[model samples]
Every structure is written in C-alpha cells, then in structure tokens.
Target chain A: MSSLVALLHATRIELLRTLRDGSTLLMMGFPVLLYPAMIWGLTQAGLYIDEARDRETLVLGVADGVDTEGLGDDKVQIVPATLETLDAGDVDALLAGAGDGLELHYRAGSPRSRRTRRVVEDRIEARNTERVDAAAVEKGADAALLAPLEVDVDAIDDATPLVQFLIGLFACAFVPMSIIVSTYSPVVELFVAERERGSIETTLCAPIPRSRIVYARVLAAALLGSLAALGNLGALWITVLHGAVLVVEDPVSLPFPGPVVLGTILALVLSAALLVAVLMSVALSAARTHREGQTLANFVLLPLIVPSMAGMLAVISESSRDVLFVPIAHTGTLLYAAIRHELVATDLFVAVGLDLALAALVLGGWMATLGPTSLIEGIQRPAWLARLAGES
Target chain B: MIEVDALVKVYPGHPPVRAVDGVSFEARRGEVFGLLGANGAGKTTTLRMLVTLLSPDGGTARVNGHDVRTAPEAVRGSVGYLSVTTGLYERLTPREMLVSFGRMQQIADPVGRAEQLIARFGIGAFADQRCGRLSTGMKQKVSIARALVHDPPVLILDEPTVGLDVLVAQTFLEFVETAREEGRAVLYSTHIMSEVERLCDRVAIIHEGRIVAATSVAALVAEHGTVEKGFVATVNGA
Candidate 1:
C-alpha cells in the first residue's frame, strides 16, 4: 500500500476511536452546554442590576432652608435633617448608626451615572435660571438677553448597544478559551493515552512513516478542537437570542454582520490550530506516561485564560487597539470589532495570518522532532531504557 | 532478504550512550531467524532500523533491496512489524483494527482481507468485540493479524510472546511456523531460550548491541552441549 493510503487509514481509525470514547464526547459537549448557561445567567444578572439601579429611589439629605421643590421629587426623595442629627443616628430608627447620612453611591464608572448626573445638574441650573429670569423681568430688563448662545450635540450614527457588545466579546473570547480547557483531555488522550497503553509502540513499528503518524494525530486533535469550538458557538448563539428576548422590550438585535460571523469562525479555526500545534508538540516531547502528557498539557489553560480576562476588561473600555496582536487576545478584539462593524480589513487579515503562521511554526518543530528513533526510544527514560540492554 | 552491516546508533547525552553498536547479520528468505538477547541487547533498535523507523549512525542495512534511510517508504511497504507492546486501538474491534491497518498498507479489499485473516487466526468469535475488552492473548492475536494485514514480504516480531502464558506462547510459536511456510523472511527477537530453540531455523545471539555468534540451533547446541550453555558462552564469552 502507498504511504498516503496508509496514513488515511490510520487517521480514519483514530477518528473512529476518538468518537467512540465517552470521555471525548463529554469533553466536546461540556463546554458547549456549560459556557452558554453561565453566560446567560451572567447577562440576566447584569440586566437585572441595571434595571434595579435605574429605578431605585435616591435619598437626598436637604440642608435647612434649601428648597428642592422642582428637582423631580419622584426619583430623588428629600429627607430633612441636620448634620448632627444624621451623624448621631437620629434621622430614622432604621438608619440609626448606618453611616452619617444617606449613601449617595452610584454605579462606579458607569455611562448611566454620567448621563443621570448631567441631567440632574442641568435641572438645577435651569431652576436657577428661572429665578434669574423672573428677577430680570421684575427689574423691567429684557429676559431674552439672559438666554446665552446654546449648543446641541446630536448623535449622527446609531451607537452599538453595550449589552450586545459585551455578549459578542464574551461569546468570542470566553467560549473558545473554555472550550480549549474542556477539550484538553481528549487532545492529550489522542497521543498520551496511546503511549500509556503501549499502543504508540505498535503504531511506531508499523509500516507507516513516523511523520505520517504524527500528522494523523495532529489532524485528529485539530478536528476535535474545531468541533468543540463550533458546538460552543452554537450554544452561545441560542442563549444570546433567548436572553435578548427576555431582557429587551424591543427585539435586541445582535450587531453580528456577515463579516462578524465569518470572522468568528475563522478566529476559532486559527485558535484551534494554535492549540493543536502546541498540544501536539508537548505530547510528542513527553518522555513519561500518558499522565505526564496530561499534566503538561494543562499549562495550555493559562494562555487561553489570559485572553478571556483581557476581554472582560476590554468590554469596559470599548476598544484597545494594542491588544489586537496578542495571540488569542486578537481573536477577542477582532470579534468585537467585527460585531460593531468597526474592523479594518488590514487588522483582520494580520490577526488571522499571524495566527496561522504561529501554528505552522509550532507544527513544523513538532514534526521535525518526531523521527522514529526519538518517538519510540524517547518515551522510555534512557537510564531505564538502557537497563533493557542490561536485561538482555 | 535482510542485511545489516556494522550498524551503530549513538545517542548524544551526558555519557553518550551507544544503543546499537557494530551489529551485523543476514537473514535469507523463507527462514525463521531468531535474534536472542537479554533486555536492552539492541534487539528492538536493530529491528527498528531494518523497518526504517530509526536512522543508523554508521554502516548500511537493507530489506528487500531497499535502503532503510533512502527508501523508507518502500521498505515499510514490504515489511510487517509487531512489537511486544501491542498498539491496537482500544476503542476498535479486532476486525476494525485489522481492516484499518490493511487499508493503511493500501491493500485491495481490506475488509475482505481482514475477515480472512481473522478466520485464519481463529479470532472470529470476538471479531466484533472492542479490543479494550479482549484478553492479552486475544489482543496479541489481533496485533499479529494487523502486522500481516498488508501481506508484506518481510516480517519482524520483537519479543512477540514476551508476556504470554504457556498455552498462548505455544499458539504464537505455531503461528510463526505458519508464517515461515508461506515463504516470508521472518526476524523474531526474544530473550527466551526455549522459544528460540522451538521456533528458530537459525539463531544469532546478540549481546551488548552486537551479534556475538550465528549458527543453526542444532549445530550450536551440539557444539556447546546445549542451547542454554551455547547462549551463555556466546553472550558472556565463557
């Protein structure tokens, strides 16, 4: 048989074996199911907190003789009290010793707070202006002269909603990162498990080339990683659609254009490729048992997590262009930019192209290291392996 | 049809261990050639080189007129190798594993070939059962079937019955005889003196990564008074 035909046969067998293993099925399914549920719950919590804070009453402590008559009495309730009375916990029994006065805390660094504060200050200034205008009219002066030139700032383009931005960012970043962690077991199993069971020895000794064997294993891992990413993407899509309906009065539209969806898929493929390359390299270099390979592969989780954490921080800042070149970090940035229709063609191409190049380099090194002598003899410790000589 | 001329394998390290050093031997077609050595006697290393799995640091080796380093693909195409550690996929059935390997070898009608091999090896009863659930003997049988699935001209077995029970070992020895009758060049590596005495047409005793002696089993036994004494004297220089 031809070498190519032999490799194909081996690859098919590997794929079948991976599919049959229940552990691999769980590895693929767990991230898909769990991440979506977690994201939905988080979205719900965020929406609830926003709604509650938006409608909740703000208690205002009024200094004596300071009128607050037309400052929207419904939203901000005035509580008449002296500083001493508040400090001494004498305002109300329920509030006794509960700090000096009404806690005027707002959501820190929230856009909502900035807007609300501006409106409140504007209303106070308008009330002062009315008083000034009345006084000016009473003095027989022109009230029109009191009205200074006013400027209006109008938003020309529709702004992407904060919730949609966050959903897209998390879905792109967190889902893939989580999938990487979840699918790690099977990746290790593909090579490490075979080594542990002595099956790798059989494979190495076969009439197939060592390079072909390594290729087959890497291909299987990459395919599995892609499947896992797809499953997670599907779950996130479903959850986002349902959660959007529940939270928004108007149908909350995802800003995901055709480019966004395609970019996300491409980003996922690149990430999966990188992950497979790194994992296969580690697996090939492993000199001990399958358990050792598994232990080493867990280090991959650190790289995956870095992007997710960075994405969470990026959601607050909207966009940080510098992060676009940081491996998986770029994936999150690209997905966010794509969803908002803000991605430049050059940036998108660079991110995808660089990621593919990195994967290729890693895979190249792994292939070079996978000659038959190393793969077969590499697994056994030389001291112990040399003892095989002693036994002979 | 296998030839080895002063092959050497040097591993670079603190001490720079020599795994296979100055190993030389030849095996003719249709012969059950035994390679007897203690553990780590470079038996597996030699076999790996012949199968084109490893590169020899020095000298030359050929299998069926194909140089291991230059024509590895051709060498692989013509050689069947079975190591002591059976590498069968646990999730696959015996039939599935065989067919997969047969296809890998680019055999025509791999499934049909796998079925015939299964029947010949008397493994038809559990052909459909997953290999993970098979007994040691059964797994070994599946492995042997996979090795022969491509029906190559050369066969190399590295301690094929190292861990098998007496009955299973006997069955394996019988299979070796069958392989020889089919006119294939066979190289069987083992440390077990009894297996060598029972199955080998001619034997090369290897020690410290080199072949110390080579002769027919009966001639060595007669010359040394017994096969065990001959092997000890050959290995230890007694």
Candidate 2:
C-alpha cells in the first residue's frame, strides 16, 4: 500500500514537472488538439466541396458516331465534341475516344465529372457488346467464348476507411509513430533529466523501495503514451466521420462496432506499456547522463519501425502465428487486425500475452540491477563517461 | 539516537578501496556529534551507510534503534540525510517538494506537516515559486525543510554549508544548534574547525576511514590548545 502511494506521488510529481516544461506540454497536448483541429479544417474544406457539387452540373461532349442513347441524368448533359464548343461554354466537359481509351475534359468545379465519364463509357460498352454478340452469332459461335474467364473483385472484409484507420496495410508507421511520440520524452525526462539535475537524490532518499520508483516512472510514461494514442485516434475518427478519408461512403455509425476500435486502441495502450519497459531498460543500461539517454532513445525508433514493417508484410500475406511472437511488430498486426474487426480471441490473447511477458522480462532485468546504491553508482561514472561526454 | 559499530565499506576497483574501514561512533539524544575528516576520509560513506543509502560490508549501524541493513526502511524514516550537493527539484515548489517527501516517508497529514514546515522555515513568501527560480539560500532552506518534512529523529549532514555565504552557513549552524536543543541526534560532517568549536558537543576526527581521535571538544582543545590545532594534529596522523 505504501509502495502504491509512493508510486502515485512519483507519477503525480513527474506529470507536474513535465507540465511546467514547454516541450513536454507540446508533446502531450499537441496531438490531442491537432487531430480535432485538422478534422475541423478538413470538414470545412469538405463543406465547400459538397456545396460546389450541389451547385454545378456535369457537361459531357461527345464526338461523331458516339450514341446519345443512354448517357446519364439531368445533372449530366452530352454536347457536341469540338475545341471551340468546349472552350466557348457550348459544353462544360468533353469526352473523346482513341483506339481503346477514353478521355474526359471538364471544368474543375464539377465533382461528378468522373461519374459522368463512367456513365458515357457504360453506354458505349453496352453498344459494343451488342455489336460483338451479333458478329459472334453470325459466325455460329457462343457469346461466352469472347471472354472466357471473368475477373471479379470480392471485398470479403468491407470495413470502411474510418474503421481501418488507414492502418491495415500500413500499420508500421502508425503504430511506431503513436508509441514513439508518446513514450520517449516522458521516460527520458523522468529518468535522465531528473538524474542530471540531482533532484532524483531526494526521491532516492525516500524510504520507498527502488522498484516502486521504477514502477512510478513506468506508470507516468504509460499515461503519456495512452494520451497520445487517444489523440491520434480522435483525429482519425473525425477525419473518417466527415467523408474526408473515404469520400464516397457516409459515416452512419462512428466507433462502428465499438468493440473493434476499442480493442485496437487498447492494443496500442499495451504496446505503449511494452515500449515503456523497453525504453526504461535501454535508458538505464546505456545512458550515464541525460544527453546520452536522449541520444539512446533515438536508437529505439529503428527497432520499433523495422519490426512493424515486417509485421505489416506478414499481415499483407496471411498473418502467421510466428509473427505473433515479434513484440512491437506483432502489436502492429494485432492492432491492424483489430481495426479491421477481424480479431479473434486468440489474436488478442497472444498479442497481449507476449507483450506482458516481454515487459515482465525486461522489468525483471531492471529490478535485478536496482540496489540501495544504484542511483549513486550510476551517477559516479568512470573515466570513460567523461571521455565520452567530452568527445560528444 | 544513532549507533555505528565497526562499519566496513570496500569499494572494489582496479585496486580495491576500503572507503570506510571499521569506523564506529554513537550519538545520543540532545547531542551534536561532528565527523571531522579531510577529502576522501570516508565521512560521507559512513553517513551514507547510517542513512541506509549504502550497505556496509561488515558491522552494524542503527538509527533510532533500527538496524540499517536489516531494517533500512525504518532507518530511512528515522534519519534525514543531507549533503552540500543534495539539490532541490527545480521544477517543484517547496510545499510540493516537502509534501512529496512527507507522503513517501509515510508521514500522516502530509499536507498539514508540509504547511507547518513552510511557515517554520519562513517559506511563505515563495512557497509556491519553483525552486529553480529561488535564490541559492532559498533553495538550501527548502532542501533543509524537505529533509525535516518527515520529522526524523536523526539528521546526518555531510558538509551542509560547504558553498554557502557567511550568513547562510551561520543560519545552518543555528539550525544545527536548535536541532540539538530539541533532543535530536545530529551527526554533522565538515572540515570547518570553527564549526567544530561552535557546534559539536563531541568531535571525531577521521583520517583514511579510521577514527584518529574521538572525544569532547574541550578535551581536544586542552590537548592542542585549540580545536583547529587539534584537527590539524589528528589529520597529520599525530
């Protein structure tokens, strides 16, 4: 119970200290507001787009011999194809065909210009198919022979862009971005900066066990990580809801199938915890001073990013159980799968289980090194650290 | 009360160092005992062991009747360790700093106790200001207040006034006297012979981790004519 209180006090003090720092404040608060503000800006841009779409009509110009039989609706008008006619407001758009290709020219204000071109292409395609069928019948052949194998796109998983968070195929960058942005500064500031300023001695002098102090640092870092993930998630949510991500699909339900998104965010939080352990262990082992700790934290970024790239590669192919054992990368695949609503109970368990186990191992290593004299021992550096500092 | 018996500290190195070799001392309630030593004389190491910051290689140290090695948490609760370099958290106000130490020490009504220390130390004028923004004397006062936030019975001070101006150092001397009058066992370590003469009821001059002389200040003055002369004699292996 006393350890718990000490942990709380340590965490509270850490946050307050970091709050007074301008850079830490920017890191903690920036992402949260940045996403929502970006969404708002994008929403405003989208409003202008929607308003333009409502106000303008798609004018399609056709060249000679192209049928006007079944082109499109009242919003779409098929006009004569000519440079003068197109340029003179005789037509707002022009559709022309080469051997097997078609080009459409339209005023930039028309949002449905592509739809208009597709409509005209469909009419021409149907006419061509009828002509081919007629020629096939004359040759005493079946129309099906014209195209024996048909290609079909089956979207088995139809999770919207908002749901996927653009993370499914590209979980590498997103996952690491969330983890690094959240965990790095807090861990370094709490461990390294405090050590440098000599304020950590007061904390060391407290009657609390060394393990409790480490626990407090881990908790503070995890809190920062969680807040950052929430910010990124909020930004993504707003971007998805406004048709900014997938412009065609309307956002009828947000946090769609709430459990999947929640599960994914929870996975990120777990990843943050895992990252805390890794970072703490690395910083403690590699850093003799605060500047060294900061420099060493940069090395952590590569491992986080590299493994995630591998995980996404595996996820792109079929996800394997072997990939589930790779720490940060596995978490990326898990979070990606969760965002897709394709996560099973085993997926969640393996990812979380491996992460928790990894954290326990790293933390155990840290605990073993901890002693009554650990802080002093660390600060009392050898001649090499001085040489290293001087060289740096 | 504080008791250290045959404490041993061997710092393993290229050539192993016996930083504190078989040092022993005791201080009862209402007494100011001074540890006089030159640089690298194990005064800090001995104090660190007594405060449970370092584990003694042999022998035993007890603070307020609790063995330091076996019962370090109780020792930490009963003793407040201070050094000249013991810095305050620049980011925290004095009140915040004191209350945090209070809570960690398991002091009940930590907020109330912190308030009491704030007033007693005359920190009300800048209690809410960051320690980094305060003057050197202000930061030292806050550091002292933090050490006492738990109201420890034993205070181990290692050169607590090394870099202070005359006034701040004099103020610390007065604080040491007050601590002694209040029945606290104050074990102070310093090279200042004047401090030894003015503050210590008894003085133990340490050289190369062993106590060369341990006796009352008056007795030392009788032998060498002055405390400074006696400190010089003890340090020169006389």
Candidate 3:
C-alpha cells in the first residue's frame, strides 16, 4: 500500500512536469492546427485551378468534309483550318476525318489542348447518336435498340476511392506517428534531461525502488502519447473528411464507425502508446543527455514505421489471421480494417495482446537494470549490443 | 548514527581501481564528522555508500542500525543526502518539491511536514516560486530543506558548498551546526581547511582511497600548527 502511494506521488510529479513542458504542448497541438491549415490551403488551390480551367476559351479547328453543324460553345471557338494550322499551334485541337473513323488531334502537353479535345469528342459523340437513331428509324429498326450499354462500378455502397484511401492512411499511419512523436519528447525530458540537470541522483536516493520510478515515468509518457493520438485522430476526422464532404459536393457519407470498431481503435491506440513508452524508456536510459537520447530514439523507432507503411499498401483478407503475429504491423492492419469497418474480434484480441506482451517483457527486463550502480555509473552495453557492433 | 567498516569499491576496467579501500569511520549522534580529501580521493564514493546510493564491494555500512547491503531501503530512509551535484526539479515550486520528496520518503503527513520545513528554513517567502527562477542561494536553501524533509537521523553531505558564494557557504555551515546540535549524525565531506576547522568535531584526512589520519580537529591543529598543514603532512606521509 505504501509503495502504491509512493508510485502515485511520483506519477503526479512526472505528470506535472510533462504538462508544463513547452515542447510537449507543441507536439500535441501539431495535428489540431496543421490538418485544418493544410486542407484549407489545398482546397483553395484546387478550386482556383478548376475555375481557371473553366473560364479559358479554347480554339478548335474543323478539317474539311467533317461534320461541323453544331460544335461551338461559350468556351470553344470553332474555326476552319488544315493540319498545318493544328501543328503550328493556331488551334487548341483539330476535329478531322468523318463517319465511323472520326479523329481528334491535340497537343498532349498543353492543358487547354487536352480540354478542347475532350469537349469536341463529347459533342461529336452526341451528334453521332442522333444520326444513328435517325438512320435506324429510316431502316425500319427500333431506335432504342441502337443505344449503347452503360455500366457503373461501385466499390462500396457510396464511399469513393479517394475517401477510403484517406481514411485508411489516417488510421494506419498518422495516428501511430502522432503517438510516437508525442511519446518522444517526454521520455527525453523525464530521463535524459533529469540526468543532465543532476536531479536524477536526488530522485534515486528516495526510499522507493527504482522499478516504481520507471513505472511512474512510463505511465506519464503513455498517457501523453494516448491523448495526443486521440487529439490528432479527432482533428483529422473533422478537418479532412468533413471538409471533403463540404467542398467536394460528392454526397460523401461520413463514416460513423460502429461501437466495436471504435472500441478496437481506442484499444490499438492505447496499446501502441504503452509499447512506445516502454521501448523509449528503456532505450533512452542509456543516454546521458537530451540530444543524445533524441538521436538514439530516432534510430530505435525507425523500424516501427515500416509496418505502418506496409499496412497502407497491404490488403489483408478477413480470414488471414497470420498477419496478426507481426507486432506493430498488426496494429496498423487492424487500424486499417477497423476504419473500413471490417475488423474481426479475434484479430483485435491478437493485436492488443501481442502489444501488451511486448510491453511487459521490456518492462520486466528494464526493472533489473534500475539499480543505483546503473543510474550513477551509466549502464554498460549488454553482450548482445556489443556483438551487434562487432565488438565481441 | 553511521558506521562504516572496511568499505571497498572497485571499478573494473583495463586496470582495476579500488576507489575506496578498507576505509573505516563512525559518526555518532550529536556530532559532525568530516571526510577531507582532494579530487579522486573517494570522499563522494564513501558518502554514497552510506546513503545506500552505491554498494560497497567488500565492506559493511550501517546507518541508524540498518545495514546498507541487507536493508538498503531502511538505510536510505534513515539518511538525508545532499551534494553539489544533487539537483532540484526546476519546474516544481519549493513547497511542491518538499511535499514530493516527503511523500517519496513515506512521511505520515507530507503536506504538514513540507509546511514546517518551509517555515523553519525561511523558504516561506519563495515557497510558491519555481526553482529555476530562484537565485542560487535560494535554490541551495530549498535543496537543504528537501534533504531534511524526511527528518532523517543521519545527514550525508558531499561537497555541498562547492559553487556557493561565501555568504551562502557560511549559511550552509550554520545549518550543519544546527543539525549537530539537534542530535543528528552529520557526515560532512569537503577539502576546504577553514570549513573543517570551524565545523568538524572529528576529521578524517583521506589520501587516494584510504584514511591516513583520524583524530579530533583540535588535536590535529595542535600537533601540526594548522588544519591545512596537518592535511598536507598527513596526505604526503600516507
């Protein structure tokens, strides 16, 4: 009971320090402000380019003996010309040939030339349909029978491909990356900065065991990581998806993930934060200063990002439970599935269980090295680490 | 009270160095004991062993009747350790710092004890101010108060006045004297001859990793004409 109380007191102190740190606040605020500003800027740029494309008029050249009764529009200027004028850049596009072999020619590099080609092709297609209908009626055949078949392919009930990709990327990559960024600064401040300022020696002299100190510090960092992940997730859902709906006018259905999916997402985020906190706490314990700690953490955490990137590209089937064995990749895959509302209960269990297990294993081993000797004289390189450097 | 018997600490390297070798001393309640040494003389190492911060490789140390190796937590709880390198939390206020350390020590009433120390140490004026914003003298006072918050019976101070101005250093010496008068065993470590002459009841002059002279300050001064001369002769003779 006394140890519990001591742990609580220690945690409170760590939390107070973490909350007052300016770098932590900035890292937490990154997603909230960056997403909105980025989306707004992108939206404005897209709208401006589209409006400019719509306002500009393009010159279209009609070759001799081609149908030209109805082709001009407010944005297209019809002109009589030969292949010479088309090649000389006098016209944006050339509508040449006739009958079943109509040819539309344009400069591929010019934006206005491409636009003009599309407009001329559309007009000619409409005219051809009319003429075909008229000819069919005169030949005593049904005009309706001449209509071309149309097919519409829908991947989901209503969600577009762009929306699905955005949601998948945000879940599999952004949230996890935010959690990592959030967990980093606090670990450095708590472990390396304290050592640099000489406060760690004083804290080590307390009656409490070093394991309790490690636990308190890890808990504080994990809490910050989880909160930052949630903030970034919420900000992403609001700024990007909702903004897409309002601007794109595509009947975009905002994904209201079911309760199960929501719960799984929360679990994945918390477990991931816990894992990162434990990993960083142990890795940074060897560092003597903040700068060194940060550099070391960057190298240690680089491998975790690969799983998230792979999850973005991988299409895991519902029956493929083998993917759950991979540590962080499992979380990323589950996150992608959960965002798409296809997550299975068994997979969620496997992912979170694996994460917690890894965290426990690291914590157990880290506790053994927390003696005063290690704290004061610095931790010696383990045999495996030495062998990894070819020192053995 | 503190008792150290044949304390030994060795650093394993290309060549092993026995930083503290067969050093022995006893500091009873109501007296101040000084460990006088130069750089690399193992003064800090011995103090760290007493406070349970480092384990003696081949010796036994007892603080307030608790053996360091057998009951390190108890020994740690019974001693208040302060050093020049000991630092306070910069983001925490003096009052918060006191309460935090008090709770870590498992004091019965941390808040109340923190208040008492603040008032006793004259830290009430800046109890609410952050440690980073305070002057160096104020920070040292807060550090002293933090060390004593647990009311430990033994106080281990290792070069606690290395960087302080004369006035602040004098104030620290006065606190050491107060701790002695209050029936606490004070283990002061430094190389300053004046501090040893004025504050120490018994002095141990250490050379390399062993004690060369252990006697009362008055006796050493009488024999060598001054504490400085006594320290030099004792160190050279060793």
Interface RMSD of predicted model 1: 2.4
- Give lDDT tens digits, candidate 3, residues A205-269: 88877678878888788888888887887778767675664334345667566787778888998
Q: Flag regions of model 2 displaced more than 4 Å.
A: A1-6, A28-172, A243-246, A249-253, A256-264, A318-322, A369-392
The better-scoring model by TM-score among 2 and 3 is: 3
Which 10 residues in a row give candidate 1 chain B its minimum summed lDDT?
A: B99-108
Q: Cα lDDT for residue A253, model 2?
A: 56
Q: Write the per-residue lDDT of candidate 1 for residues A1-392, one digit (tens) a residue.
A: 56676666666777788889888788777867886677678776766665554444433322111233344544333453322233333234322322322222111112243233333335423443454345444544355544422212222133236455655665657655755654565566666677667786566656566767766765666667667776776677656655554334334555444865675566646464555445544543553555565555655666567776685566557665677676666666666666566667787777777777777677666456654344333444446433432322
lDDT of 2 by residue, A1-392 (tens): 45566678778877787667777767766766765677677667766665554444433432122333354533333443322233353422121121122222222223333333233334333443354335444444444433311112222244455446564544433544676666777777767776677766677678877777776777777777666666665555555555333343234354554865686657656555556545554444446566777566666766666776777777767764557777777776776676676767776777777777777676666557664245233545566754544426
lDDT of 3: 0.75
Comparing to the true complex, what docking class would candidate 3 get? medium
Q: Which lDDT tens digits does candidate 3 get at residues B1-238? A: 8888999999787698999999999999988999999899999999988887778899898999999999988988998999999999999999999998888888989999999999998999999999989999999999999999999999999999999999999999999999999999999999998999999999898778998889999999999999999999999888
Q: Is the docking of candidate 2 incorrect, acceptable, medium or high quality?
A: medium
Off by over 4 Å in 1: A1-10, A36-163, A250-260, A340-342, A365-392
Candidate 1: docking tier = acceptable
Chain B TM-score, structure 3: 0.98
Point out the worst 10-residue segment of candidate 1 chain A by lDDT: A102-111
Candidate ordering by TM-score (highest first): 3, 2, 1
**In candidate 3, which residue ranges exceed 4 Å CA deviation?**
A58-165, A246-262, A315-322, A369-377, A381-392
Candidate with maximal lDDT: 3
- Residues B1-238, candidate 2: write the lDDT tens digits: 9888998999989899999989988998999999999899999999988887778999998899999988887888888888876788788889888888888888888999999999998899999999999998898889889999988899999899988999988888999999999899999999998998999999888889998889999999999999989998878864
Name the TM-score of chain A in model 1.
0.61
Q: What DockQ do you compute for every candidate structure?
A: 0.45, 0.55, 0.70
